[model samples]
Target: MPSPTAFQPVATAMPDNVRILSFEVGHGECTLVEFISERQVAFRCLLDAGRVLPAALLDHLKSNPRPESPDLDVVVLSHVDNDHQGGLPGLLEAGISFREYLSPCLPAFKRLRWLFGERVNRAVDRAFAFEQQLRSHKVAVQYPLEGFKSRYASSRVTLSIISPAARLIKTLASGSPERVSALVSNSPTPLQWLFEVDEPVNEDSQALAAVFDGRVTVCPEDFDTFLPGPPGPPASSLAQQHSQGDPDFFGNATLNDTSLIVVLDILLDGVHRKRLLFPGDQENWTYVAAQHPAGLGIDVMKAPHHGGRVYLRDKDEDLPGVYAWLRPKTVIVSANGQYDLPRASFRDVLRTVGGSLLCAHQRTFEALSAGAMKQPTATSCFQSMGCDRGRGRSVTVTLTADSESADLPACVQGSGITGLAPIVVLRQDVTVPSEGLLRYTYGELDRHATWIKDRLDEARREFLNKLKKTRTAFDAITEQPLTSWRVLAALAKADGRHDLVADPDPVLKFARSQHVFWCAPVTGYRASPESFASLPAAADFNAARRWLKSIPSLLLIVESGNRFPTGTARVEILQHADWGVFDHLLAGKLKHPAPVIADEVRPVLLPLIAADYSFRLCHFNYPDSHYDGGKAFLLLQRDSVVIPDLLSPEWQVAWDWHAHGSPFKAPWKILAKLASEQMLAGTYLQTPYGRDALFNRFKPSTTTPLPAAMHKARWVTY
Candidate 1:
């Protein structure tokens, strides 16, 4: 038996340098920092673990062993938001130990409970559970204070807490915890409970809330009244409605505003240094910007709130001030399409502020590997030791003290680091299949067939195992079978698979029928095989033809193979009797003038035309042919165009004579001309450059023949 191929490690050698790795966890932030000493001793610090521990981070933990013990130097849970701290439980379960755990939530939980009232006890309880987990792992837990600094004496790496002032905590704790509890108990409804705890605190919290309010547009008016207690009837009405649906919205925002913003300064041999500013979901940028320490320029900035639009002020005034203070050259954001982040507006703002945007979720390891192969020096660390493995997106940066500042790559420069090499590593798996048909033809055929059968059996077992897991998960979610199916259908749709509704299984069919109003067809067409199968034979034939044309023609061709042309011809005969059967048959179906249709339908149509009219469509080099025409028509339609210059006096006569004077006028010429017009129209409609040029040339004149010649030229020879 052949050994299973192993995935090559992208980076093997660990140099005595400073490096940062940002993992893509879908609308979350997870960063790992490594400081290696001259003697190769290393200290690792993690900043948040995102909502889930990505497969790549877990792989990293398994692959990279610590010199002394399998432990991280520090783990900073910057905030208690699910996106930031949700992966902690999984990391601990994986036996990845940490020396110190730092977070503001652990120490300020008591005060946070008082500010939010007893109704927010669920969030508070989760935080307490997290703290207990850290303690169970024998990790040192510390609360970040304003001006609190932790220094790794050996490596000269210092992390300084710069936000959530001590006074802020005191202000939040000013109201009596017992008074809030009593108010919660006596409240008529959960909505009233919030109003009861709306007693005013210090001016700092109010100012922070005011700053946040100006930025976040969708925050309910009730949340504002509940926090600052501005007397208004509209607020009361909103509070009543919101309490029935989402009561904890304001509490979540308040928790984010109190995130521990930190500045990490790394010094190499006392002279060479680098700084990173990690503001974990801190939306109160105005307050943080005002308190910004002078002479603190950041090399890289992990943008707050996953580059959310809410962090940017209405007029772009606050962001510029913040950027001016920190002067970050590279802004890293961790986001995915699911969350609609980081916002395009925020990215534009970053670009305007002269900062390069590097999104973690957009970079894949396979792409990085290809990039490394093309530019070895620029992406030197991206070399794979065996094929890459993981399901995450990540960007890695390696900085060396000895490397000359002038010799640094553009990426390193963009990140504001003077002497660094940046390498982006993504989580991907590369597999190489076996080649050579000789082995299969010889004695290996039987063995190969048996091996394939065994593999299929294994796959079936694995699929069944997965189904079992799904069933268990569904059972845990709900007791009712129909409810489980509906929930699963919704989850599947959210994951971008709408075909689940079309499954032939009785359960899925029932689920689809029940949710037919909400569950639209994935391909924008309503007809399906099951639907057609249930119809009468006479109606089914018509429905089937419509369904065939509605789907992608390429899919039909691939699925039916040689049967496609016959099937399509039968449908074509039923649809049209004359006017060049195939052309007329496709005209109505591909009427949209969509390039996608042309691209898919043309390749299959061309071959069918050639096969059906063998004598009429003989190769160009054949003895009977007058013009150079075979598959050349394909090229003419796609590449060559009848520009206005060709229709001018210098070339028109020659072209006309050459085209019309042919002994046998080519049938392909008509097809080619139609294809060209379709191609041009598609291009003009799809592209801005083509559209602009087309509109610019649209002048009102009877003698103007250029537009017709360029876009609507007819084949006179055919």
Candidate 2:
């Protein structure tokens, strides 16, 4: 094992629901959504009609395919910017197709779409992929409607339109830029959630909200306004055909102002589901902010126009700034890294949202700071490549439901938590196979027959000894209120399941008995055994149950970390029952009734605890990459209120990094090691590392920690 460092990359996989597959293009990119149903299918939200999809994206999608044959569902065309949809033509070339076409229904973009109208589509008739395949399969877009309540293999997904409201459109076209500015100026950040009065662009941009499993995510493409172009010459008569209601386009109906906005309330069997709001550059959040609906607390948000300062009023700088309402746990700002999102504006938004900020292309140095993307860098993921390099007006987000919590990193390298108490399960199950000493060497079987027989005999004896345990084991429950005496007594008589080690047959029998829905990963997360380390474990309802059963043994007991850039402690004990509760365990999951816990008899509990660890560390240091910068405590646990200077003095990054750029952090490795050791032990360890120092100082905790020390100091009213 190598020394853990913040720069060490953690492995991340796409969620099971839908994977957002984006490809690098010239100046933009293309992203496709896939739904895991009876088969794996791509949701074609965009199509070039006959042009190319980004080469990178197309290649990745083809090579990394879904398990079941997936079909394309909804096709989206977010306003016809050439860079945005340059790959629409590629879907056909790739031999992939979908059913619906999500057009902006905008008159401006409509002109370009008209080029592919009935006659044009017929003329280019070399059997365009998406539409042609859809018709053949008896599936057709035909026209746009209200919304779709789509479900694939137990993972439910939905998309709601929240922009282009009638009233806002009328106002934008009839007002001056200043008037539009005034209206948008006071609007809350996460324009989709802010509502009171109306802003022009927020009203027009097509805000599309997506719900995966139970989490809410809204991608308001460029909700923040930064009016481009000097007011174009007044539209001609033909362009003005529909100007009866309003005259000036920017004044009355700024294209950016005509977006759609919506919030989702997803639930199954009456259980409230996760929430998400999509505000398509609606200048102002009209309905969301006012209601503060469950979905407004979206977990993932795409920065409006890559955090353009124009969307925010000049005054917010003095206050909070644009990251107010759309405080996504993970915010992906798609912009040309070198341009857009001024440094000042970026900092302002950080202070406002107080969540992780993922700026594209490392545009501003601030993007790399802990206050922004603070978590350990994730590069092993196939997706992270070129992810930071967002193409102009090209960003894709996919919401999937399989194992909703951001999939645990394939391997957590620098998490500062590992090697806890001797793991009982690991010790018992692990096996070290011997080198090839088979019977057949040169025509091996006969040559090494004696050696092979001896090895087999030894293997059988070891296996038998390991399984010869009768002291403690699992058994069937024949009573109720599992915590009661009746069930406890019967537990002893039942036989410990010997088959649970490999076969899920026993687990499935338990699940069906409880009437629980066995919703497992269908496509994206690679639920099939063929995907794991050649595990060859059969994948099905039963297999999923078995995997769920082993979670208690597999999960690490460290404070949960996030993909978001926050130093707050999101700790969790995977053994608790909450682990299998789908997206409900995610902080961003809406306040829906938690899904029914898995079998009460063989009950499991996965409690994720959010704690404040700053009290323990209470210091900071400047990052070596940003050498001289001061380091204050960058992390604060959720729900924790951190007082300033709880420690003897203001902290900086690691002391070594400040004194010597990168090489001097030698001591840092030691400190990090100590931290990892304590974290791995969770809270149950005796004589823990940092615990002693903190316990002696602040003595703060949930119950009997400490009382504030009284001190006298002269107050100066500067």
Candidate 3:
């Protein structure tokens, strides 16, 4: 991705402050400005720009104002780089003339020298052209700085210059040829001063002060602190030179040492704030100590020389004004490319004095490249304060595999999944998620099952959504003759997650519609029908209403109850041989008692067979086992086929997969058996409430197994 530029306009400036917009690599553009108030603004000094006046960004700045407002008081040029000055020429070309202004005088500019040639003065010639443009309107020329500001008391614009003291310039101008040449050579050229110089050889470079509420902000453009004083000099020589401390021969630093470093103090509406310090291409430390005795404390301090040790104390131990003076919460290193501020002296300044730092470096760029963070810009440092804890700890879905369960995706662990939990991925899943979305991989991390399963689930959901769009056909049954049994089965399949319905609204739409009359069954209805004796009544409005749709007088019946032969009253009884006629007679109290229960040859389900075809009860019978009492006789999905034993909490908890189909000739039982055999290869049995899945590799006796035609069947759940 393309990296955004460092400087951009936030909004139009007003009487008190101006707003600036900038973009960072991983983050988008951010706009901030100066606020004018009284209290020192203290440790939280931010660049305060004026009010955002009414105007379309690019248009307003360049066009002249109407006659009613006239023109502005001052046209302050903060700095000379393209980012800060991109619109200045157009504004100047327009009739929006300012009374007074401040800008650095350029000695030699590569572009103007290239365009207008060296012989003709660039600044003078440009000023002359501007003068001529004003004359066209019969206006008099007014030099903004020296004469105009001194004469006009009405003009509120004032620049308290903080750089290039005449005293230091005089000393440098009188320096030995070698020192003077070194200073000039070492000083940052107009091109080197700023990172994004669009047209090279910025001969018109004006490294002025950036203001926030009349306070200055330091824009340290490409200045390095690593330039040692007189390259080959030993420590003793420097120490000897430093002890003398004569202003004329400060010894060792360069001529660019005379370059002005500014800190702006802004006051407005009873709010006083010391904004930022903009260190121009000057690399001098001692000059400040000698010229100004106080330690310079500021709100935001742009790093000197890109965090180099050059800005050190006499002994290079105490970081001059850092700890005692600077109060920088944000130390920006605005470099175009990569560079690490070396560990030693710089860290001391940061730890002891400069405070926290932010930079546009390799790591910042890498995050942008990986799609994890945004690109480089001025705002990125402020935005990225703490490391983000992505997806931290509230996921709910889980996928279980035999000897493995990779349901939870790894990317999802720290994040919340309540927001429509992502369909876990699976190769065999319905569909794959779009690349645009964030994916997860959390199942068995060690074995990497999670990765596999999540992808499968995602794939499955993808396919199923498509599958629904294209309908599939099967053996046709009459749509009519619809029973409560069929409706329950369909509802169970649609809502039960075992079928994995990615979209629930449509399926649920159908289920809710079945409640057309939307009436409640008789307050938690429970119907009890008996075959030989009295049958229970249908209790609710829906059950009563259902009779209107039912075939009249359909005799729905329950199975006969089991009655064991009784013996004489005793705690323990003998076998059948010990039983006498009185025992049999007492059990039934009849001379000839007809049996209520069917014989053990076959398990009878009279309640199911005699439902008169309106409803069907699906159940399974497990042969009696020694594990507990008798094995549980389970009702897979029936309201009336419940076992009396289920009432006991113990049996309810023990019966895990003990449900539905019995070992009979029923089609459903056959399908269940087929599925059991196929899944048995590496199936797992999760108990009613199991933490772990136990492997069940049960294979059937028949090798042929079931055909695909039979395999297509859907296995209903309990």
Q: Encode model 3's per-residue lDDT on 569-638: one tens digit a residue.
A: 1111111111111121111211111111111100122233233222211111212111122212211222
- Candidate 2 lDDT over residue span 116-175, tens digit each: 223222322332343344455554432222233344334455666554443333333233
lDDT of 1 by residue, 409-467 (tens): 22222434455565755333222311211111222222222222333334334543554
Best candidate per lDDT, number?
1
Q: What 10-residue stretch in candidate 2 is worst by lDDT?
A: 473-482
Candidate 3 off by > 4 Å: 1-90, 93-97, 107-158, 170-179, 185-258, 271-273, 301-324, 329-333, 338-718
Residue 342: error of model 2 in Å?
6.4
Q: Candidate 1: where is the Cα deviation over 4 Å?
A: 1-16, 39-41, 110-121, 153-155, 176-245, 293-295, 310-317, 363-392, 402-718
- Index of the highest-TM-score prediction: 1
Give TM-scores for every candidate, taking all chains together and pairing residue i with residue i: 0.42, 0.35, 0.28
Report the alpha-carbon TM-score of model 3 versus the true structure.
Answer: 0.28
Q: Which ten residues in a row have the lowest lDDT in candidate 1?
A: 553-562
> What total of clashing residue pairs does each candidate reach?
4, 85, 70
Of the two candidates 1 and 2, the one with more favorable TM-score, higher being better, is 1
